[model samples]
Target: MIKTQQLVKNFVSYKKKPGIMGSIESLWKREAVTKNAVERFDLEIPSGQIVGLLGPNGAGKTTLMKMFTGIIVPSSGEVEVLGHKPFDRDKDFRRKIALVMGQKSQLWWDIPAMDSLHLIKAYYEISDADFKERVELMAELLNVEELLHIHVRRLSLGERMKLELMASLLHKPEILFLDEPTIGLDLIAQDAIRDFIKSYHAKYKPTVILTSHYMQDVQALCSRLVLIMGGKKSFDGPIGEFERLLGSDKIVSFNFSSEPSRDFFNAFQPKWSDNGLQVEIAISKEELCPFCAKVLEQFEVSDFQTEKLPIERIMKELMMRPELLNDR
Candidate 1:
């Protein structure tokens, strides 16, 4: 449903010196610099898939989304969404897509969320009956039926976000673009939003491109990930493959009934803490079962578990050493 080839966007901005003297010199002699926000990026997304777009701040994830939505035209290259060039901003193209930014509100602050939803329905020319049906379904899915009459200004951030999501999906767009959909929300609210997104996708199968700093959001909603760093594609694959990219090592954390001697852990070189009562060991994937058995046999174990490396740690590695992606 979406395709791009060597897509690039360059942003030109001026740098000025500090102070009045610098301001005076900036009028005609300002220094201009061009930053490549997206460089030689290529991606293909098929229908009925949710792809997570992930990167650090200033890594161009947002810039790429803007290009896809036609909010800003790319400096060069090609982009097509649902068989129409996004840069053209065709009526049919706009009708088939929706973009939601957590930091920005589409709802009218002084008016009720229901009023804003009605305006969206009218703008999209959805039939009254269809609009009502869609709103009721979304409200139920998001548990926001009571908030619909609340003014946007009075609603909590989470409440307003639910309304924003409802507004975006009312048209039943073929594709949805979510940029930080759960930013600044509490854990409960975040889970609610994630569940709603999952349920909606299950029912509608709309192609979704989600960009969020919250690893939980990506983990809960996306099976595929497209990771970028410095405006270049770093990794693109299934989420499991991305996890394996970090390597075959797993972390084993355990709590013993009592503090173990340093000699007891000498063979494994475990990292111990909490007065040596808690220990964490890193072992190869191949040795996980055998090592677990050894630990259980040798120690009076109270609690034990194995975990893969966290996604946040892998992301840090990717951002610092993007060349690792070249092998992929």
Candidate 2:
């Protein structure tokens, strides 16, 4: 279980002057800018669920994740994880949660990942039998048995990332906060991690909060989403509810061999837009067939394509019109 009530975190940043004289003055009297990374961010995530922590850069996704992991204490309010205050940094609390950041690595770069695992095992005081069983299980789940003995510096980005997951999951934390877990991975590698996360979720049933710019990851794995913007809670609800924001309208596009006359387009009188297609029609989700029939009668259409709003476009639209993200 996890919950945050009026959770707030602010950063004080000093402003430096442009010129050398101004820079010298900045040393004596600093002008600090305060940024509210999270302002009264309220969250309640139950166990055994994956919640997408979605927002653009500087939207407080990473800031919230850090606070949950006990690495950074919130400036105000309460955060309780599994019945313990996270910022207390209790050893018992640390043992029950794991945090993985995309740009940061907990593994030793110069040595084999197994070496790092062993070191963590000693640090956590894991029993020999428990450590061996957990390592073997995690290695198989992550599919990094062969790469375990290889140096992390020599491994590919995907390989190192898989190893990082293995390291994080070794202690079997009850709560996991993954920030951009698949940031740099290609489709193949991303799918692998997605599959692993799914299977791991099914088996372990931990409370998971995953933050990423990649909408595909959220669409693939998270049924529920928690949207943040400008350091505030924008929305928190099912992903399906978010999809319905565009009203399920269908987009039908046609390619023409030549630009038809303005009169020809006027006859059809479709919702005029810049599709480079001489003509573009907006059809209700249920009226695709009739709309296509109406279009084909006039223009010499070479190709036609119909598509629903992509996740990326829906996200962009929501970002532009933040009211669309209002919580249910």
Candidate 3:
């Protein structure tokens, strides 16, 4: 379980002016700029839930994660994780939580992955039997058993990430903080990581807080989504509700054998593909069937399909125009 009330993290830095003259004048007179990376953030997460924290760059998602995991202390407000203040750094609190950052590496580069894992086993004081069992099971699940003895620097990013995850979960932490776990991975590798996380959560039931740029990762693993914008919590709800934020209309795309005139589809707000052979349009549920039939009859259609509002589109819209949430 986790809870935060008016959680705020502020960062202070000196503002440096551009150019040589400006730089030379700043030795004693530089202005101090204070930024609230996370401001008045309030959140509560129950145990055994996979919650996705989403936002664009500089949206304070990482700041909140750092505060939650005790990597950094907040400027003001209260935050409690598993009944302990994270900033207290209690040994039991540390033991019960694990934070995995994709852009950061926990394993040594020159040593084999298993070698690093052994060090983690000692650090966590895990029993030999438990360590061996966890390593074997996680490696098998991630299909990385053969890479266990390979030097970390030699393995690909995907392989290294799998080993990193195994190392973090060795002690079975009660809460898992995953920051972009599938970042920079190919589609296959991304899917593999997502599937492994789902399988792990199902079997172990750990409380997971995931932050990812890839909506696919959120869609696959999280039932709840928390949207952060401009250092504030903008929305918190189920994935279905997040998707339906823009509207209940269906997003349908059609491929045409020949380019169709935009005028005919103008009323539907069509978004055409680069080659102009495909167009995606939003149609209200009530008009979906009739509109499709009309388009089929009017155009030389090659293929078409429909889908619910996409998370990526919603995120883009929100980032570009935060006012979309005014009605909420």
How close to the true structure is residue 280 of candidate 3, measured as C-alpha lDDT? 89
Kindly state the number of residue pairs that clash in model 3.
Answer: 0
Each model's lDDT:
0.90, 0.83, 0.92
Q: How do the residues 237-262 of candidate 2 rate in per-residue lDDT, one tens digit apiece?
A: 89887666566665566777666545
Ranking by TM-score: 1, 3, 2
- How much is the lDDT of residue 242 in candidate 2? 67
lDDT of 2: 0.83
In model 2, the worst 10-residue window by lDDT is 264-273
RMSD of each: 1.9, 3.4, 1.9
Q: What TM-score would every model get versus the actual structure?
A: 0.94, 0.86, 0.94
Question: Higher-lDDT candidate among 1 and 3?
Answer: 3
Q: Whole-model lDDT for model 3 versus the true structure?
A: 0.92
Tens-digit lDDT string for candidate 3 (58-157):
8999999899888899999999999999999988899999988999998999999999988988889999999889988998999999999899999999
Over 78-110, each residue of candidate 1 has an lDDT whose tens digit, in order, gives 999999988899898999999999999989999
